[model samples]
Target: MAFSTITNLDAAAAQQHSHELLDRILSTASSTYVTGPVGQGNGERVLVLGGTGYIGRALVPELARRGYRPAVLSRSAEVKNEAEYADAEVIVGDATKAADVAAAVKAAPTAVVISLLSGRKPNDVEDCRQVDHEAVVHGIKAAVANDVQQFIHISDYGVYRPELIPQVYKIQVEGELIGQHHGYVPWTIIRPTAYFPYLSVAFGDVKNGLKYRIYDHGEWNVVNPIAREDLAEFIVNQVLNDDAIGRILPVGGPWNADNTVTLKQAGEFMFELNGKTPDWEVITMASWDKKIARLGRLSKLTKQLKPVVFYLEAAKY
Candidate 1:
């Protein structure tokens, strides 16, 4: 039996091509070994939402490497060019729209549906809610409708104690996702600590010849930030390990004292990586408070600053 790749198709063509791809994958009589919660099996079709995003880009290829044919749903046209998706089937569609999501879900008899969707913009809370919460809800419904055996969700550790308003939406979405996982279908929620790439935001100031900014006197705060590739491997492994089912795993970087690094240390490391010396300034609590007060509750700056504030607060505990 021979296999083929599908690309750059319209909605109708994409749906038809998806079915053909699934039929080809499922028709294979030979069983390939797979890891994680779904156990070793044949004819396992995995559907990935947000497969074009950071973790998804790594995960789709990882799934393909593990002998599972992963079909990634994306809303972008550039998915055709992404080298990471070369091994997997790419479906162009919106996860937020029921018709689009249903089409993807119905494309194959999916054994597992993994959602890596999140808001791309930091300041847009509404868009975050739409993608993180509403679109996730849509994906869940579609999975249930299609009899998907297991669902794996990529959530943030910030959902543990959601203090910031933006984080509350994520928490809410987590609840809704878990609540919807009833009957025979089980769910696994992975709440990973900060990604190493997220720390690159501090580099923005450096680009303007400004010193790296730290909150609260640059005191060392231990945070275990995982690499996106490592996290992708962990997520895929969950699909083979039944122990992960019906559990919310709070995963960090490798278990080591070195895995934990303060933001100041992280900044210094970033500087060293860029072949520069560390030059950082501290934003005292008093200064932060004054800035917050001046911006007022309704200010866009306030919303933008809240995550930084929350991170500082979290570092203390």
Candidate 2:
């Protein structure tokens, strides 16, 4: 009977089952569950790594508005004069360096440290390792050494099925925190789905009469991409809260007609927004898979083909 059940499981069912099992394991091994909010921040200093990017612009201000002292670590001092960072104390440091991360943590009495660090180049493996995996390890070590109350890591939801290089690194960082590989610091791992900008990348092309490329019927998966502002609010809500400690929260926007959509549906909506007939450049999954396989072989000989393969893999993801 067990063998029969295992054989009958479909791909989607297997994926869902895997996620359920992983969640149960993490929850049991991490911390005991607690209910209710633990009140507001009382002037706790929050050191935000990677706070000069898209989500950071919204999160820093939100943290300040909620009575938390927001300190942003940026490589550039010019951000200090930026209006978005007006409420934040800008600390000049590079996230890729362990010493810089440690100094930034010890520079002030940091109560919480949030790592929003991700690689800018998803196509580069070395960059992903340095920024996504190694940089986060730096923050984890710093947070532990400084005795920070909480370490919140913003991971990708796609780590559940890590097909891309960046996703693999995100998974590794998640493991380091959950296993206490570096040291013991109360941690919250948030796996957020695609952002609005990511899903809307093709909007401009579609508006300009370019065919929106998609695989198979583009109905393979459905996602509800969240806005940066909404995601920032959610992240702040988890800050310094006992209920959120040692939790793996998979977050997205509201599940409604407007938000929840398949890739094909997303493309159709873009066409409607631009008042144009939908012109899709649909490619079969079998052919796309073959192309990826061919490129995978070529990447071994030519390093330039690596990024091309990465992009193809990411699109399939």
- CA RMSD per model (angstroms): 16.1, 7.3
Show how many residue pairs clash in every candidate, following the order shown: 8, 0
Residue 275 accuracy (lDDT) in model 2: 100
Candidate 1: give the clashing pairs: 35-240, 36-239, 36-240, 36-241, 37-239, 37-240, 37-241, 38-239
Per-residue lDDT of candidate 1, residues 1-317 (tens digit) = 11111112243443355446445544655342323333343547899988888788788888888778899888876786778988777788998887898899898778888988887744455676688878877778888887888888888897776644435666676677667643345789899888855566667666556688776545324566787877887888888467988899887675344555656667777787777877877666555555544544435445666445433433322
TM-score: model 2 vs. ground truth: 0.84
Task: Report residue 168 deviation for candidate 1 (angstroms).
Answer: 1.7
Q: Which stretches of candidate 1 lie over 4 Å from their true place?
A: 1-43, 181-184, 201-210, 297-317
Model 2 C-alpha lDDT versus the unseen true structure: 0.83
Where does candidate 1 have its weakest 10-residue lDDT segment?
A: 1-10
